[model samples]
Target: MTAPITQLKTIEQQLLWLSHWMIHHANHVRPKVDDIKVGGHQASSASMVSIMTALYFSALRPEDRVAVKPHASPVFHAIQYLMGNQTRDRLEKFRGLGGAQSYPSRTKDTNDVDFSTGSVGLGVAITSFASLVQDYIAAKPWGETLPKGRMVALVGDAELDEGNVYETLQEGWKNDLRNCWWIIDYNRQSLDGVVREGLFERIEKIFDAFGWDVVRVKHGVLQRAAFAKPGGDKLRNWIDTCPNQQYSALTFMGGAVWRKRLMDDLGDQGDVTALLERHSDSELAALMENLGGNCVETMAEAFASIDHDRPTCFLAYTIKGVVTLTCRQSAKASR
Candidate 1:
């Protein structure tokens, strides 16, 4: 790995540990007067760790603004804590009264939160309007000196179901939106259940129709490298055609099950069999789960590859709760 990528990996793990620790502390360590569970959304925060790390550490600039996904508040608070913008006391009291806000809040959060995000689709919808407002200000004579910045929304795929998001898309198209980015965490699983298969295809079409560039960030470096191997095409095809729930289940089951499934499916092909034998169960699991948005290096590269100011939507594939599971396993091992 390059120096920058190595550094990013370190930071990614730190953020993951800190974020999960904060959630665990809130639920298990902190004394509770009531019987209510202090839900910190550990899985939601884990899914966004890589994307947020890459965006904040590698892709974002000082002037850029972001409306973080509501469920990712733990990760956001962890980031702020690392940057010395949040206090440990607040983290210890997560989801409690006078504690860290359940969501990123401009008014409530002491840290630098560009936009307050709470309601499902509201945060995602407002970024386009924020971008338009920025443009309007920049066009005026008095506002000529203002530095232009990207208005970004870190969105959850489930948030796409909101009618307001589509309404904003139409409004943005009508107003000629620019300098905006909506990076969707396409983890395939939501609070209700697995997302519908092929929903991304429809999402891409909608973005294209709205004059926004759609970038599908699917495979990570490992998967892309694996695909270049002799039997890699079949593996790639299998991943592409695999149902969302099946893939998620395999991921949750870990590397041994992944190996068994792959062997059962592609064992007859000599080249594919050789490819499968190249890695142990743990290695195989990591490789299979390393989706683009979950890999910090891949996400950084994707963000860097975008050169235009036009509104863009990055449909980034990720494994929901991957980091949290890893953290739990590690904790058990240490114990």
Candidate 2:
């Protein structure tokens, strides 16, 4: 790994631990006045950690602004704490009265939150408007002196179901929005369940119609490297064709299940079988689970590859609670 990638991975792990720990502390350790459970979206925060780490630590400039996903408040607050923008007391008081707000708030939060995000799709919608406003300011003589920056939204995949997001897309198309980015955490799994298969195809079409560039980040470095092997193409095809729920379940079930499924499907094929034999169960499991959005290096590369000022959407594939799963596996192995 490059020095930058190493640094990013370290930061990613720290954010993952801090965010989950904050949630655990809130739910289990903190003194409660009532019998209510203090719910923090631990999985949601885990899904965004690598993406946010790449964005904030590697890709983002000082002028850029981001509207963090509402459910990822823990990750955002953890990032702020790492940057010395948040206090330890506030972190300990997460979700409590006079504590870190359940969701990021511009008026309430002491840290530098560019956009207050709480409503389902409001955070995703506002980035386009903010980009428009930025353009409007630049058109003015005095405002031309201000530095222009990208208005970005860290969006949850489920948030795309909101009608207002589509409405904002139409408005943005009409207004010719520029320098806006919506990075969707396309984890497939949502609160209700796994999202409908092929949702990304429809989403791509919608964005294309609205004059926005769509970048689909599906596979990570590990998967891509495997695909370059002798029987890698067949393996890649199998992964591509696998149903979303099945893939998720297999991932949860870990490597032995993956081996069985792959062997059953592609057993007689000499090259494919050899490829499977190359890796142990845990290694195979890790390879299969390393989706693009969950890989900090892959996310950083995606962010860096965007060379235009036009509005863009990065549909980044990830796994919900992947960080938590990894931590659990690590603990189990250590025990």
Candidate 3:
């Protein structure tokens, strides 16, 4: 990787560690006065780390604004902390009095925040409105010198179920929406269950019909690299066709299971089998887990590829939770 991409990747992991540690501390290490769970969404933040890194560190300018997903507040704060815009003190006191807010709170958080997000669907809807408002402002002579910006929202895939999302799409189409991006973290796993198969295809069509360009980011640099190898095509195909739930299960289960599952599915076909045999279990797992949104470089390249002023939607594949199941439990218990 080049220096810039390397830097972005480093920040991505840093944000991930700080965010997860913040949650862990609040939930597991902090002294509790009562039985209340000091909740933080560790998985949600994990799924968004690469997406946010590409956006804030690689793609966005001072003028561009983003409405971070509600569940990803730790990442939002951690990024702020890394940027020197936020303090370690607040991060250490996360969810405590005068510390970072559980959600991005404009009134509460000391660092810069364009839009306060919570209650799932509302922040997403607001991004579209913000775009419309941007247009409205730019149309005026007094506002003509204002720097134009993309109103971006980093959203969880499950959050798309909100009725207002479709309403916003329709309204944006009617208003000739431009300069807005809704980057959906399409991890496919929800608290209730896995997302319906082919939902991304449906979402793409829906966004296309509404005059917004949709970009689906499924495979990453690692998978794309593997695709260039002998018989990598079949491996790519299998990954593309895999079910959401199965993929999530395999991911959580780790590399040994992934190798076994891939080997069993693909059989002893020469090139394909050799491809799998070339890597250790850990290496295999790394390749398997490298979905586009989990990779900062992939996401950065994707964001850079867009040269248009049209409203865009990025369907970025991500792992819902990066921590182990036990850590997930700790996160909730803290909450």
Would you list the C-alpha lDDT of every candidate in the order shown?
A: 0.86, 0.87, 0.85
Q: 169-259, model 3: which lDDT tens digit per residue?
A: 9999999999999999998977888899987788899999999888889887777877888989999999999998888878978779998
**lDDT value for model 2:** 0.87
Best by lDDT: 2
User: RMSD, model 2, all Cα superposed?
Assistant: 3.6
Worst 10 residues of 3 by lDDT: 325-334
Model 2, 69-120: lDDT tens digits are: 9999999999999999999899999998777889999988899899999897
TM-score of each: 0.95, 0.95, 0.94
Model 1: per-residue lDDT, tens digit, 29-146? 9999987888888888888998998898899989899999999999999899989999999988888877788898888888988888988899998899999999899999999899
- Counting clashing residue pairs in each candidate, in order, gives 0, 0, 6
Q: Is candidate 1 or candidate 2 better by lDDT?
A: 2
